[model samples]
Target: MAAEPAMQMPSLEELQHWTWVFGQAQQMMLEQGLDMMAHMPGPAAMSHLFEPAAAFRATADFWSDTMTLWSRFLTQEPGAPLGEDAEQARDRRFRAPQWHEQPLFDFLRQSYLVIAEHMLKGVDALEGVDARHKEQLRFATRGFLDAMSPANFPATNPEVLEKIVETKGESLLKGLQHMLNDMARGQLTQTDPDAFEVGRNLATTPGKVVRRTPLYELIQYTPTTPDVLKMPVVIFPPWINRYYILDLTPEKSFIRWAVAQGATVFVVSWKSADASMKDVTWDDYVEGGQIDAIDTVRDLLGVESVHAVGYCVAGTTLAATLAVLAARGQADKVKSATFLTAQVDFSHAGDLSNFVDDEQLALIRSLSSDGYLDGRYMAATFNLLRGRDLIWSYVTNNYLLGKDYAPFELLYWNSDVTNLPAKWHLAYLTDLYRDNRMVEPGALSIGDTPIDLSSVKTPSYIQAGREDHIAPPESVWKLTEHFHGPMRFLLAGSGHIAGVVNPPSSGKYQYWTNGRRVKSLQTFLKGARETKGSWWPDWIAWLRGQDGQTVPAKGERIPGKGKLKSLCDAPGTYVRMR
Candidate 1:
């Protein structure tokens, strides 16, 4: 091997300058170390150090401004606070308070994590690093703390002072973080080579084919025991997310619950998108994806109609599909409709609306110019909106104090990426969020026919979470007003994901409905029947009212039946790239 050129040595002047600077850094560390010790509060007062009282005061000020703005937009009488009158009427309501008017401490726990952040930065700056280098160091340190999943920050070993004031502190933090990364890497390798693989496999697994519909290729849940129902209940999951959120785990899996109910269940797993799918539109999903499923089920099961359940975005799409069918007087195909935390109106939408302005839309459009919206970008936006929980919580725990990452499969699953076809997203954002057009009859055309929500006379059950920030209670309630059909709106006990996945065995989750309108859903459920087991059984009973007794066998389908087969397989290709 060739010898490298000899490096020039530093002059005595440069060496002397660095030596003096290093000494000054050591002096500063000694001073700050003394200051930290002297100012450190006793155990009784220690909690205040991490409380960040100033930050809380700042938060209170911000929310005060926000509440004033939001209060004006409530649909009730101008004087009363939003949702309060509705709550007053509810017999079994929590009187869920809006903390915007309250002190910040009421909303967030005093995070000692903030103390860890302050200590890390203060020590790094005292070490004589340049401002830029110090910032980098700060971030790296924060990431380490975030990974650790520490219980609380000020509570960490006071001994961190001993390590940080010396060169040894830097090495200790770095070494511990490195070990943690190695362990997480190994654990991840066992479960999934990459995050997307977990869902990809679940989606693609072959089983008994319940129905081969044009709108989808579905996976049927095979029960471990004897069969009950002949015609299957086919689920239409929104294309926005992967299908397996329903089959999250053996314990809480909705499919597992359904199988236990002795009903044959099938779920539509959408094909992942690629450049070729850029031209696929909302119409394609309905006409191509959903319409085909109706026909496919008719052929495969010999059943006249199948019970259709749509989740979130899928529920909206399903509602529109029913409208088209109803317009054509073809409502006989779907027995009854069930919506899980789904939205039908954008009126009085939540803060997520702030994310859908022209500039952001343009940025997304530019991205789709390449064929697909990078799912990672979409995920980042949603994650940032809850930064204190999703981003900062992780940052403080993993990067700052050098801790091991927790094995949270749900979080891991959420991080897995999936792509959105450019055409589909563009239409959805413009039509749903921007125009709020879906509520109007014939505002959107499905094929040659006009889609109308009021025309949807299908018996319907809609569920929403009281605490869901994604689709607020008002947003979900918009469905009942628009459908002009027999409707039951249930306000579940938790947030977005929990409301939908709630199993009855988890205890009584309240739902609401009567022949007449109640002041609020929470109030209505108070008077409604209390049931055991999952709500799925209640839904099954509703659908059974509309379904035929005889189970049909497989027959034939249109030419497009095989067109979607090429798109099959798990994580399907669209979810992997991001």
Candidate 2:
């Protein structure tokens, strides 16, 4: 059989041209249809015009609001003077003295052409149209006007305009300096691949890796290697991001540390859901994903039970999976469950609540009716949550300073997002965020069983980050009360990702663990032991206690036929898909 040709995508310029052509075609069709309608005496065409006009006006107002948003952001900062050390440091590192022009020029050139093209069509549509269709054309015209308005385009803002005038020639020097620095540092991210090599060594010893599991394939880590672990640990990473984050580098990789300590580790690398996987839902994720993974590990390793660790949204799904397991009396398969900055409750979720309200949710529902939450939309929402850090800060650094943006590998990795199945996203928002249903005993049902976290009796480890805005300390720590387990609530010092990936080697990080069996987080932090160094050592020690002693011989080793077959090559799709 002959190989079919590969698919091709158009360049950005081609895409822009096609976009203009499509808009023009739509406008022509609407005009012809309107002319036909005017000739007729029905109200349907008139009604159509009204809805389109209203939508246009709404969009116009939206851009108008956006034009003013930056000013609001600037004012919102306390005293509006960059005095804080963190902010100052960021400015010094990113800001180039008197750098601003190319971006502003580029913005102006692009916006003018796009706005002019669309505005002209809108104007022609409205000019000699019957008064009956005027309202509809008015909206389309208004949108064009909004786009073309000086206030909305280019370096017209006082700060931006002034920067252009003041920092013309000096920016060239600064740009050159930055380029030299980046080149000296070995590319832009300063990523040391040596770190990966070191971590790989720490994780895989000589004659230890008997079989490597293929990426995105289900498999078990067994006793084939002499360095086999006693505690069977399976890590479920959030499909929203890459799984390798847990094992970013040698100094930072959590998986490497666990291996060194003799703990069997299994990690699920979720496939990036595409058009084919659109119909997948929250239930599918649990049953076909994490649950399937759990069963695979159990049967392959021949273990009575296994320990499961969930990160972020993965943690939320894990909680739901446990509820399903307990309801069906399959909870016996789980030895213990750990949640890392995971939320089962979302009643008072901070700023994110602002976006998940009725109007936005409705917009999402309408846009994602095709069964996949567009990854771009998800990225935009996350960008908004930390607008200062993700949006404006970069704008100031990149646009204001005529500096070429050097890619940070971490940020680059983060920008590479995976699609969320539309069904799963809607269910997640409605059931978990909008309704706060997961924590409720019977609000959620998996198959025929209702999930009751209180019924979950497995030993649990709940880690909440002190600085996690997405999953606040209070919101995440609340999971302890829901789980009727011998639980340990540890407060890590870093944000969501850093908190869990922490290896005691990183200096200045801390975590709190109360020696006494505390009832909840509020009480536990009161007299908790403030430990220094990495939380990795602490987690390892905790697992050591839970893990059975490592046996030296085959006779003493746990008897289990490793039945799980390798599905793909090592360093699977889960970690590198994005």
Candidate 3:
């Protein structure tokens, strides 16, 4: 390892501010919230949407600024402050002495930012295009700017050069080794892959696989306490990824926390879809997936109903299943519903919406020749969304800095790839993103039943991450408008995953709450009260209030009366399939 850079680093306050900047962008960039739309729009990815005149103006201004910064580079000192954006101080990428103390590198940094800012402004100034097209352009432009940062290139990056010199070329050698290792694995090394394992440290929650269906396997977690909530809790995790995200390490696991709180928890572990499952439709997910999950929980527990929870796309399906059931006059099957960053209404579906038009649809079909759209494509799109962090940061760290990434259970779960069934994924994009049909009265038909969200009478708790890029909080907010129920909408302090999976024990981010239904999301945020710590407690308290009854835990783990038996352990075969 090379010695630390001689230049002083930014203060803690400045670092925190940069984190804020990144947050707004993750909150800006990319699962996405649902599989409906996360990839870049074909048109946006191919070219810029800026007007020719605006482009010229932006380039001329950027050129002037670049020349000005270059000429004055020698006059600046490492300690000299970049004006008070407060955000730039926090970038974290250019921390070495050369980046600040040296003139050329600092000029490179400022020049990139100058042109990037102007380019975005030009996109904003674009005319003759709809707002959706404009947003797509802005997002694509941001990705390009993030990729073009001087810090990403070894030749241009001062920190990497310093590392090579300090380590006498050992850093470059080690970087080649790391890059080659990641190449062989077919994924970026964001964390030490050896640090975490599924059943060993990650999803170690004690439980049994109570039921197995073609689409998923239902795992009921063992309760830590002797007594448990009368209503068993069933979770529907997004099929786009593994269920273990909610069941991470015991310390951070939302499932473990709920079980410890005297609630029985069951999660749907989706199978990594393959060509055999390519024909599977969204209706299967609604009926065969979530419906099957809840039915197993109710039947195996010998109960009539249970509290239902869903994350990401699963939440979308859960809501649809509820609507379908409610229309069929079986609304009581799910006593209450909790949605974690799920968007049922897609009208304002952020940057991802541009990825759902006819052109993109044709492209997806071509890729789905094997019955599934490779999940890696979606993961890649998400990486592009947060390229500065997920993509470039790792490239700089693993392949340039000659340093191994720290073990992050979240990133591990993220890298544990899962594929999507072509039928279900396509239906999601077409019906939801392209057509905006989920919220329509009878437009969506799951299991031959017309889906009507208004008919869903179950009490609901809707949670959205404030800076969620994958499922923009604003898109999640639209669900509050469509779902007819006694609803509680909350805005958590971080982006999608961090916001939702945040454990109360960390005492990290805060959550905002507005019990009253407001007309606009902005209004909700305005009148909302902010509370420090995780929103897990608030959700649990709300869950308990739905029904204060209890049940004996002694034999509840013994799912099914006599015929049904445990197929496997929790975090079952399906999750480990691929």
List per-prediction Cα lDDT, in the order shown. 0.58, 0.61, 0.80
Runs off by more than 4 Å, candidate 2: 1-216, 219-225, 517-520, 551-561, 574-578
Error of 3 at 533 (Å): 0.3
* Lowest lDDT block of 10, candidate 1: 103-112
Model 2 per-residue lDDT tens digits across residues 426-516: 7788888878988888888877778888888778888988888788888887887788878888898977766776777768579988878
Per residue, candidate 1 scores C-alpha lDDT tens digits across 1-578 of 99866645446575456445433543453345335433433223222332355435534543453344233322211333322234223412112232222222111111222233344634343333444334433443444444332222322323233335544567357645654763674221112224434543333333344333333455655444343466567788877667777776556567777766656566776765668788888888887887677666656555677778888888888988999889888898887788988887986566566566577688899888767787767667666555446665444345444444565545665565567888888788889977899988778888889988888888888887777877888788888878877777766666777767776666645544444566565556567655433566666666566553532222112111322222343323333433
**Alpha-carbon runs more than 4 Å astray in model 1:** 1-216, 223-225, 505-534, 548-578
Better of 1 and 3 by lDDT: 3
Using lDDT, give the best candidate's number.
Answer: 3
In candidate 3, what are the lDDT values of residues 1-578, reduced to their tens digit? Answer: 99886766556575456445433433232212111122334444323444567657765665565445644653443434322146766787767767775655666666556656666666677666677766776776777777867798898898888789889999989989999998897778788889999999999998888788888888877777888898989988888889999989988999999999999888888999998897899878887887777776777778889999989888888889999899889899999999999988888776677577787789889999999988888887678778888999989988988996799999999898899998888888998888888888998787568988888879999999988987899999888788778899999999889998889899999999987779888999889999999999999999999997987886755443224677877778999987
**Model 3 clashes, total count:** 4
For each candidate, give its TM-score against the true structure.
Answer: 0.64, 0.65, 0.89
- How should the candidates be ordered by lDDT, best one leading? 3, 2, 1
Clashing residue pairs, candidate 3?
A: 25-28, 27-467, 30-470, 33-470
User: How far in Å is the alpha carbon of 132 misplaced in model 2?
Assistant: 42
Find the candidate with the highest TM-score and give its number. Answer: 3
- TM-score head-to-head 1 vs 2, winner: 2
| Clash totals in order | 32, 5, 4
